[model samples]
Target: MMNNATVFTEFSLSGLKDITTKNRVILFSLTLLCYSVILLVNVALIMTIILDEKLHKPMYIFLCNLCINSLYGTAAFYPKFLFDILSDTHVISYIGCLLQVFIIYSYASCDFSVLTVMAYDRYVAICRPLEYHSVMTRHRVAFLVGFSRLVPLLCQAIVVTMTSKLTLCGSQIEKLYCDNWSILKLSCNSTTANNIVGFIVIFFYLGHNLFTMCSYVQLVKCALQSREGRKKFLQTCVPHLLCLLNATVALLFDLMYARYGSASVTQSVKNFMAVQFLMIPPILNPVVYGLKLTQVRYSLLNLCRCNKQVKGLN
Candidate 1:
């Protein structure tokens, strides 16, 4: 980690503005539509889980938490991004940038934790079918939700502690937000300690999720041994597999391209990764689970029809 004197009070980001105006317009419109869909669907999901006690199980609880996290994750970065595109300015103050980074990390981390918890829920539901209810009780559900929320806060606290110690005396970040590596790169002093922290954070980020995925894999294998169980097991695992695959690819590209590529290349890579990371999970999640699992779709449709009837009566 290089520690530099804080020379810049604000930093400018040269995001996709260098592209053609026509392309920018197209992207802006698409982004607006996508954001609208994300907002509508996630809000509906949260409300459905909250209003219906029948859906108030550990699984749906985690699903609701995931939706909430995705909402925050999108809100943290997308508004500023849209503004930058429209105004032709990517400059952000130090404080706002820091807030953006913290929010992004917080939500992203929470989402990861919730996914792990969801995997565990699935495991118990499949592998230990008899004890699913006992193992994933209300208290356990509350604990999982609480744990997911707090872990991200703790991780961010550690990050803030480390970043606060750095002396940004001479340089400024080039990105739209105050990212870890971008800030570290701007440090005028040695960045060794910061690098170490980053590595540790990555380990924490990947370790829990990977372990959970492995457990699920084993559970899947066990479930597949029976001919009748094979189809149901595949249905249960495929959505999760798609989500994991999308997230992993996005994260890998975000890490590698941001570090090694040229500015233009980095932005391009991040632009695509941003869509995958920000949009695909939320969009595909409900679709995956809803379409793959008939019960959820039926519940959602029932809720929709109920709402419509109530509106008509009113």
Candidate 2:
């Protein structure tokens, strides 16, 4: 079954047609700008942590991982989108589609995993500041990072392997990019196994990780009895909570949407929201962190200065 499915050479993509030409041009420009900023900002975040050994603690380490995942997520599809806009091609090869799904899932899932780990790190730092160093030692930090990548890594492998066996005939995906549920909808084979595995994975992975984060939140609150500590705790959790809410909504919407079909107009509106869930998070992340963290703002200022100096030298 898998071998035969792989033998089918090509797959058609339902192009972005509902959007007007003006909208397309605007979207193209905005997406390009957003991706460029996402890349540069995330790379800067990573480099800042790497260069500054003072920031080598667990929090910064997790932040670096988060930045990398955000970069990967935005980069996975943005370039292809730009190419499609320029070349006017709506079709993608089956292999290419699978690759897209794999890369996007890897980045996105890893991002969530890293966020969960980061919440724990913050909890340790704030809630148990006395033992923060002892608890989050270098080896332990490395383990968390490795574990974050490992979960998503294994999940993506399973999804791709399973999906490769299923035949996609008669239906083409209608999104700007190929998403998991959307692609699964096209499978000629029964999706019972896929749905079950996907649900189990989400429950085990997202559910548990999110629960851990929530537990840390409560702990952080308990530790923050002092007025200043309570304020700082709220400040730290706000951005993460917002991102988490956005992600949760997007996931639920995708799952439910797959089960119940929407009207064409409704689907279009949902598509717009879907893009928001995917694109907004990465873009908003830097903004959120920038607004929340003093260090990130200072780093941005320094980066601007360095760029100005380099341009003058050039």
Candidate 3:
């Protein structure tokens, strides 16, 4: 047996090992297509928001941050995933695995943090319309955005740093990608410190969810009492609600699978549960906001029409 101080150099990812060579090609093509669409829609929405002066509002600013985060989160996984699908070997360097753990978890943490801020933004907008401008000022919005990004970066950095110091006994990870928990499971020594910190991070985000729910609960109660409030709720809050729900479900699926998923479960099902978070939110978020938000939809249409006109003139 390796001693406690011994370091592992690499890990074999067993998740994709079940995939046959013939199926890998098919899966690779489909994954490439999905990744491309995610990139296109997210980048398009981000650029649309950036270019249009009309969308320079607090709400749209939050939405833009959300889209940028989607891009950031997906970039950590899809490129390496696509490469792995084509290659026969499913291995990641120890350092590379730790980096993936940091990026993936931080991306998730950032999502929850951003959503919590968005909920607060909506709460202030609907529940305190007169004070919305004063409360969600440019400075405040910038601060909130920075807080959302920085907190996750810091938290995940701590988690990853803690994880990297541990002496790992195993080198086989049973997942499609490197996950913090999976890496933790490989430790031969007691992971009490890891578990405590992990729970703290988990509970921190759980509080974010609770805060969001409370905000929406109050927002819904206020919206119920007025016609204009209902209109605003339907126009603005519904998309945010949809996004929150999507993210919650995706994260839950991944969490459940990570904690209690069984080998008896069909590999296909297991694979779906594993990657659903990566696949769904990155693509669906921009689509939901783009279609549901009137300003964004109109801006996208105008941008397309101008492109077409320029092409015709050329």
Cα lDDT tens digits for candidate 2, 1-314 = 44334445655555565566777788789878878888777787788777666667777788888887887777768888787766555777778888888888777778778878877876776777789889999999999999998889899879878887887754477777777787787776789998888777777667746676676667666666877667756677667767666666765565566566575656456666556555777767767776777666676667678889999999
Question: What does each candidate score in C-alpha RMSD?
Answer: 2.6, 3.0, 1.2
TM-score to native of every candidate shown:
0.90, 0.87, 0.97
Off by over 4 Å in 1: 1-4, 17-21, 169-172, 262-267
lDDT tens readout by residue for model 1, 1-314: 23324456676665554667787788779888888888888887888778878887887788888888889888977787777767765688777777776787777677778888888887887778789888998889999999999988788778866876667754345554556677776666787987787778778979967877797777878787776457657776677667666666666666665577565555665567544667777677766766775556677889999989999999
Q: How would you encode candidate 3's per-residue C-alpha lDDT over 1-314 as one tens digit per residue?
A: 34644567888988887888889989999999999999999999998999899999988898899889988888888998888998889899998998988888888899899989999998998899999999998999999999999999999999999999888888989888999889888887788998899889989998999999999999999999899999999989998888889988998889867877887998788888988988898898899999999999999999999999999999
Candidate 3: stretches off by over 4 Å = 1-5
In TM-score terms, which candidate is top? 3
Tell me how candidate 3 scores on lDDT.
0.90
lDDT of 1 at 94: 72
How far residue 177's Cα lies from its native spot in candidate 2, in Å, is 1.3
TM-score of 3: 0.97
- Which lDDT values do the candidates have, in the order given? 0.74, 0.73, 0.90
